[model samples]
Target: MRFSASEGLRTMLTAALVVLLLRWGPQQLVELSRVWGEWSAPQQATAVTYVLVVYVLLRSGRGVQRRVSWHLSAPSATALRAGSALASAAMPSAGGSLSLERRARHEAAHVVGFLASGVVVEEVDVRVRPDGSEGRVVAVDNKGLAPVEQAWGYLVGAVAGNVQDLRDGVHDGGSAVDMNTAQSQVWRVISCGVRPAGYDGPLTADALFEGARARAGEVLEQHRSAHEAVAARLVEYAESDSRVPLSGKDFDDLGVGRVPADV
Candidate 1:
């Protein structure tokens, strides 16, 4: 099976640790025997407790992370949510004057995620400061989307897009807000602000994202081609749109608020 560098290093370290302990364990036991009478009962208990704590951390640390995701800041859930929460809002402005390329790509990913027939392209109007900073504001346009598309097809596409946004060599990361409307809510219910299933920890932003991105294999294995087909269509649509071009749109449109790709 294909394994990551981290996994290989982990295995190597574990084996080395085992060997070290094997070599040192007997020597330590002999040393302990030499001092058994000198170590107090409380001191022995403390040593045992430390070993137990370390063991628990080693074995169940992952479980703790997965289970405690709700306690983590919403921004740390994954790159999808981090960018979406900012860019998809009703008013998406950056903390500072943002790059035109970053802005273009951010809009591109969401349009791809939520793309459908007859959707509205709500232009992202950011009021930049002298220093140039802003946040993201996502959109929800169902004005002409068919009701069925709004409920099902758009739903699948949204999940597909969300999963797609994190693949290797996609958009870097950007603040993209959510519109908080029914159409957007339906998609978010299934895709946004959720932790990766395989990882458990007190998630740092890095770990949460790494875990989410690591799902690329599973996501693509099952849904990659389908999502890519849709994203490709989106890129084609954007290329034709007056709004999309140049700066930094590495990969790359919209209709009425709708369901997902399943439809």
Candidate 2:
């Protein structure tokens, strides 16, 4: 919601221009009509064609600019592929026997984070696989969020899981995928030219990841009760059927206040 001085000045100038146009627009339009009437049929056609071509070129240029900006900001294909491969490779194996309860808490934390940030979480699921327990929280891609908020959303799952693990005096090993995913998202945010608050270091994924991790931890700690309530509910669902995911409505029915208390 904040704007630089230059932006404020530009907005003021634009408003003034709009007011002037509104005052003089009728007279200008009448003058334009007079000139148009004086033009021959061929001259009118040529002018219309010229205006159309200029409009088309301007629109095409804007579209190309938008596309280039998006490409520059978005994560590269190689980074995405590497993140996926790393997530799969770093998954806990069957030998470790990851508990269903832990997986439930992990996914529940994600749901809490998304809901707190005004993102729409569709479902959360904890599955018991032969290799190990795994969980996922499916959320709508809310592109309207600020970059810092999006980074917090991405990092909160791992931060909350780690906090829980520390509380229980257990070694945490299930958040590799979460961290990997968060790092990639942080990289994308940095590429988009936004830096995390208090970050003055080189523009690297690691720096932003740490900043985002700390902020997510702070926010999750502030809403610890909500997270705990969600986690308990997820555990109850897993007890009945670990495969059945909890819908957004199910979480809403719990009556726990979202982290921000408002969307």
Candidate 3:
């Protein structure tokens, strides 16, 4: 009860401070906005030009941000994603290397899945679906895309990334993802026949999903190695002054025509 009372007192004091600041802040801001009205004509022109320049710069910044994340993944999507990440932060065990950031862990895990299942990750980017849902889309730069963009292979990687126990095959789907639930979600996507543009139907969907799942399980064994590689590459990319081209077919190499796969 004492603790609650103290907390209440603190909250009231903070609220009082906010009220006081609000009471004192408006007049100064009002004066600042009016000072511009008294400027000489040349000074007014300069001020207007400055405002326009600032506006242009803001627009340019938005454009650059849009280039990375727009329709598929809005820049604002991070607001949603970061909130979840913060709410679900989990510290590692005593022996587990704590150096890996959550992003590094997720990127490493997903990258291994990408390599094993052949998801083609040269230009993977976040995007929003027409259904108003957010997800990622990876583009293959031909060099990285497997000859056969098997829907099952990609699906298996995704499922494995979602459900696999990264810790020691004994985890309960840490804050990152839930293994059992992840598997179920993957199955639902397949059963619903809602394949993405490239991974559409052949009848091999069911069989391939199972095969991919099994293959992904094997790939999980190399999670540590994969995680390490991901961390290294992430640092390498950060230091390098380069960008991955977003061109090329989503399911095939540049010169190589659409390589056929069995769904």
Candidate 4:
């Protein structure tokens, strides 16, 4: 019920990866152009535009996350690792504002889920679990984390494909096809869980060769940590807002006494 800290880190890492790929891919493409001189000026322009859009969206999202952290108390500094305002680059712009609107809704849902998860936005109580994990709502809200995180993943993967197309020459051999496949693969990994929808969890030559399930599982693991970090930060936010002394009986009530209070 709490946000997964690992998911936050995964989001940040994914954004960073996308930014790096978006920036570097174009540079590589441009350098390749010098040698190949195959792509026309229009093609070059389009490639550059795609790369720029991805990087810009990621950066913008990071900025917005920072700003909101400064102003709000629920999401917390976890934005540095697990937030999604900038992932909007992945959405379709031509579909009017529907995509953007969905992103907004998801963002709100994320914040609300954190609050609803017992963050106390004001207080805390704690009970230690027999398993040694503290019983508390100090975690960030990661409920439905898959949708938002996967959406961003899809965007990054798509940008990677677009870049690859430019590098390989979209018209050359199977360049465009490869790109499409990679993009689709990325989406499937994100959307279809550790396997594609209706995949029946059975391993086959194609699945093994594709490594789709393995890759998706890896992503999910990464996301798990980011979500936890985010959830912890949300607890910190609650502590800060409540102005409660984190070392007292009330702290136990708010679920902070049993855990290390490292906001």
Name the top TM-score candidate: 2
Worst 10 residues of 2 by lDDT: 78-87
lDDT of 1 by residue, 63-135 (tens): 8877676444342112112133433322322333344333334344444444332233233322223333232
TM-score of 2: 0.54
Over the stretch 98-175, how does candidate 2's per-residue lDDT look in tens digits?
666666666666666666655566667665556655566766544766655455455544355555554555454545
- Per-residue alpha-carbon lDDT of candidate 3 for residues 128-247, written as tens digits (9 for 90 to 100): 223221222242322443324333344544555444435433232343432332343344445545453334445344554565555555566545455455535544443353355221
TM-score of each: 0.28, 0.54, 0.34, 0.18
Report every candidate's CA lDDT. 0.38, 0.57, 0.42, 0.34
Which is the leading candidate under lDDT?
Answer: 2
Backbone clash numbers for all candidates listed: 59, 0, 6, 36
lDDT of 4: 0.34
Q: Report the Cα lDDT for residue 160, model 2.
A: 51
Clash pairs, candidate 3, are 72-127, 72-128, 73-127, 73-128, 142-253, 163-179
Q: What lDDT is reached at residue 196 by model 1? A: 23
| Alpha-carbon RMSD of each model | 17.7, 14.9, 16.1, 24.1
Candidate 1 TM-score to native: 0.28
**lDDT: which is higher, 1 or 4?**
1
